[model samples]
Target: MSAVPNQAGSWSTLETPLSEPIMETLGLLGFDAMTPVQAGAIPLFMKNKDVVVEAVTGSGKTLAFVIPIIEKLTRREDPLKKHEIGALIITPTRELAQQIHSVFSTFIDDHPKKDQLTLGLFIGGTTTLAQDITTFNQSCPRILIGTPGRLEELLTRSQKIVNTKELEVLVMDEADRLLDMGFSQQLSRIIAQLPKQRRTGLFSATMTDAISELVRAGLRNPVRIVVKVEDLTSKGSVQRTPASLDINYIVCDPEQKLIQLVRLLQAELNDMEGARKFIVYFATCACVDYFYKLLKQIGDLKPFSLHSLHGQMDTKRRTATYTNFTQLPPAVPAVLLCTDVASRGLDIPDVDYVIQIDPPQDPKAFTHRCGRAARAGRKGKATVFLIRGREETYIEFLKLRKIPLERGYYRLEDGSVCDNVLKNDDAEDEKITTSEVEDASVAPFIATLRAIVKKDRDMHDRGMKAFVSWARAYSKHEASFIFRLKDVDLGRVATGYGLLKVQKCPN
Candidate 1:
């Protein structure tokens, strides 16, 4: 029943000497044998070979590379000697950087071994470069982990990393994210600053084209490890976010989505679980700021409003927002209104629910957003609301996975489970998708867009172009296209064509 995979996606024999504390933490966290992802990726790291790990979320990826890093700390002479930055870890967001650092720190603290190594967290918004430079000057910290921008800046501006040549191993935690943030160019630049002899490690939930190019650019001939597909985490049947969840979808007018969001927050205030940590996912920075200001004005909700943590926020403010959310108490309900930027790397352990104020970019991103709720074996909930007219997407989502379409308690106010949801039942007969096919899951959505464009459509037959544009844009901003009737209308036929179908989600 454990979510951890053994090897890539299979099971693993627990033979490696992962710091004693990590072993204890695994047991504490309810892990037995290594998960498939961990099993496959660990050996590559152990041998100091560059690695690219592709597995689903929650597959015990943190330890896959951390063990090798720790083992190297022991293999090297004078373990605490900070001659140079021995290890460098880059993450997309401050929250994720802190989370990876914390997990490593926790392992080190608990491990009966590894008492001599000194690890330093070089992050922006709080720890100044001067302080890190001084620490490096003192020459005590062995490992350096930080956000990409800050670390890249430190290497260029400070002589500490360059003088010591301590950048021995580089680990990119959210490899796909780093690629998505358009850091491919930045990563190439940063890697150039370091010696080319170091080992590289990459971990991601998905292997995208940009990420594949990143591996080619960053890693040498590397060990390609794949896990069992069954072990991979995937989309939930009814809830986009599974793991630990009880989701409820509400229906409302497209224009009233924001109103629906506020109403959902109101519902959480009275949940008997009394959990306080929450993240409201939006599709755009404009929505984030708009909701932030509107949420800030609400005085009686007993919730703390967190500002925009998107690309627009300065590193300093972004770091601070991350701090307040993770470190602050739940005296009042803490609501972080954020764009998809915070969805991947950040970890807020106590979060009981993730209120997707807006729909997800696609099924893949939707599941990832819901994943923010449940972490480290904890249960969580995700709710996505669509107005009645737009509800047929329910069947479409479930059909893509071929999982049971059981209708849960997410009935409409009128007590109907399949009410008004559009699904294509005949879509499967086309041989592209089975009859059980539902709305486009994450991958299918992207593939659908690509497929539409692949076919040369009539220049005047906007049927394909409009649908493709709508599908692509919908993957970015669902609400943005609510009014683009041309694309929505076209997509109903061209995007999925015969492959598209509408159906209700099973309970």
Candidate 2:
């Protein structure tokens, strides 16, 4: 079953009304109406049905399951004991788990029965297993939220302290990512331990054959909820991304990628009316680390606050970075250089732009990466950087998947030094093509980067690592036919990375 694209029903409109506390909390949270996903799935969940929800990111998938979990627990005849878990929410990443926990806390903290219902977070990066066990025993949290590895360990090891005999709901948020991250074994083990009679909800942005297998095993005869985006311009076309999101792509030489990125950031920073928050995606963790350092040293980008996050970072640092970026003030211009770690289910407020320096290894991730912006019906823009030759064919690959793209243009006033381009045209026509902008900015920016890297040993080593890792990652892209490693211009790529020499990439 699919939700109507424009459905925005009130919380009270469900067949079974939610408790006063939930309704009151929803009002306080400024959620006066439910999005289509929430409106469609919440009623079924309330009626005790297994739901497989495939909706775009930032469509409020969190609260669809969250509200049902809270309502079902509150309506239970037998109150959950301190040690008994009423609901278990497993997501692929610690940052996403933390986000869900924060949402639950917002409601529970305002509820009248807040003392009776408690929430516990058990992702194991910052805290040890012993600490989690201690908290579980002492707090007797009724709801549990965590990553697969930590959840599997806690569920199997601490049976006495972690009771699920009364478990009512099992939600796998980002179910596709859970499978992508190779958590099938962990998910299987966790499912075997849970009560077979519980309500199961598997939420994801996209559905795959692997996810289908998981649904068969984990969920009962499930009701599939797909919330599709209607293309406003084309009557019969349905898009994977929100209509509010403006997705554009720029084609540049391999060597011009970095300077083009800097130019875009400069443009966003210069636009006084635009939100200063931006998310820039890199191909690998090494790239995030290298660029995070490289961008910090650039004189032009110094006005923006820079942060880095990747899957390889420790739990504490990743969580801290996510929190800091989400809480950044609208007045302060900031950019987050990250891997797909921040792409899936994060809802950073007022994100004006999402810049993709590298296309994701998985094509489906393109939707999620862009979904980070233009969320909750808000207007946002995303631009992906594609190299000029075979890599440019990726645009067609995405088009086949119902994701349309528009050619991106750069404003001449975006600090481009290209004097050859016309400067006296109308405002609409003053924009320059990617090549013109790249031609003007590439040589000087590359020289400056090389000089900076030559003087700093750490920067030199980081550039080499990032280049090697990026090449390997490209080789493994799902669309190998289009992103063939053999077609890459290694010398130009090295120049883009500010490397002293082109290094050999590992097979």
Q: Which candidate has the highest lDDT of all?
A: 2
Give stretches of model 2 more than 4 Å off: 2-5, 410-438
TM-score of 1: 0.69
Where is model 1 more than 4 Å wrong at Cα? Answer: 1-13, 21-35, 78-81, 109-116, 125-132, 157-168, 195-197, 227-249, 266-276, 296-300, 303-309, 314-317, 328-333, 360-364, 387-507
Write down the lDDT that model 2 would get: 0.87
- Cα lDDT for residue 431, model 2? 27
The whole-model lDDT of each prediction reads 0.60, 0.87
How far off is residue 329 in model 2, in Å?
A: 0.9
Worst 10 residues of 1 by lDDT: 431-440
Best by TM-score: 2
Q: Residue 336 in candidate 1 has what lDDT?
A: 80
lDDT of 1: 0.60
Mark the 10 consecutive residues where model 2 has the least summed lDDT.
427-436
